[model samples]
Target: MSFIALHPLRTFSDTWRHRYLLAQLIKRDVLLRYRGAVFGVLWIFLSPLFMLAVFAFVFGNIFQSRWPEQTGGMPFWLLLYCGLIAFNIFAETVSRAPTSVRGYPSFVKKIIFPVHILPVVPVGVALVHGTFNFLVLLAALSWSGNFHAHALLFPLLLLPLLLLALGISWFVAAWGVYIKDMTQIVPMLVQMLMFVSPVFYPASAVPAALRPFYDYNPLGTVIESTRSAVTGQSIDWRAWGVALGFCMAACMLGYAFFQHSRDEFADAL
Candidate 1:
């Protein structure tokens, strides 16, 4: 068997080396999403805004939701949007990961293609949508006079999440190639995670007993930190640092697992 380096450096280098192919795949994925639509590429901006309107209305208007950790003049919807966007990035990526590689058996069969990068494509696509969502968020915050320079830290906060999502993507994408059940299982997990995470409520609302697990969970940590950034509050760097370390290990371990199982993908597909 050919040796596959599982180091974090190796994952970064492999991704950088295939930057062009990754770009093309990302482009294709984005374009294909709105290919036949009347609004075409415009929906990228509209889709998120539309959803935000619905969520804001449902929660901010009807439910009149107020967060336990509410700060400044930030409205309920904006608070929800801030954390929701962070969670959406992870959810969007991992939810699609299962089919990222399995859907394209041609790439797996092609000797010249790099199949290892398939899972990474979903992360790229998620970032694209996330960028637009962030922009929309900034516009909303600025309009509400809640915009702060700290909001710039939004992308910075997502680093750990992107890493965690990518690692899980690789592991799930490979399993999906063989098991097929991951398609159904992964989304259910994502939905369950959304409710448990701080995407809707503030992490402060959780009781002291459960606070540690909630904070340590990379998913909840990112969302909580991101909300802090948007609200111009202090972040628990110690917790953020721990989450980053855990996510980095996940990325490396996931890469290793994907490469180890690479030989079997051809047969499975």
Candidate 2:
């Protein structure tokens, strides 16, 4: 009997059919994060809220430094909140991706599973947290009377960030199986990347010559654009278009690299 080989699309379809398994995996991942916390799942909403309050109180009131180019007359706190939403997702995904597959060695050895989707669990959990954070931002903005019509563009602006996270996760997750050091390295790198990506500061903070780098950097573009969307500030459409193209290309390249390296995972592990 001649056998047919399943294409990647076919493999994805087969994987999608196992939605129940995916859901169970996602739930376990989500719950595990809060297992030892005091408030448990409430931390999902509370953590960011607490952080935002601290920033608003410290930077907005105590220091009283007016951040340049305030968006729609929004407080610096609200502007930071807008950028933090997208930054948090990328941070969560990149920090967690390295451990995603390694943490589930048994799944690789014992179960017949679509192992490729394993890297996505962290991203899924992060997105859930980000959704909560977004709600909190909306409430804060509305309370402050800065919730502008441009807020509708926030999600569309974040699409590049989501893609970039997915791409980097695939790469890091694949490398993680081979090098145990990735667990330590990735989180530190993500922290550094966070500062460099314009989360807590504006791209304008960069020097004029360095501005091009910030404009073209995929992570920086998303952060700035998402902030713009929420603040009714005009977006640098050209920079954002460049970021979109870079993210899409990176995603394709990362997936190809991941698939190429996937076969070696079991042996490396």
Q: Residue 91 of candidate 1: its Cα lDDT?
A: 95
Question: Considering summed lDDT, which 10 consecutive residues are worst modelled in model 1?
Answer: 1-10
lDDT of 2 by residue, 1-269 (tens): 10121243443454468767877888888898799988999998898899889988987889875556644387887887788889989999889999888988877665467777888777778888988898888889889898888887887888888878877887899999999999999999998888788887888888898887786788988888888888788988888888887887666555666767777777777
lDDT of 1 by residue, 1-269 (tens): 12355677888898889999999999999999999999998999998899888877998789987777555368888988888789888999999999999999999999888998999999999999999999999998888899989899989989999999999999999899998999999999999999999887888889999998896798888898888889888988788989999999899888888888888898999
What lDDT does each candidate get?
A: 0.89, 0.80
Residue pairs clashing in model 2 are none
lDDT of 1: 0.89
Give me the candidate number with maximum TM-score: 1
Candidates' RMSD to native: 1.6, 3.6
Global lDDT of model 2: 0.80
Residue 170 in model 2: shift from native, Å? 0.6
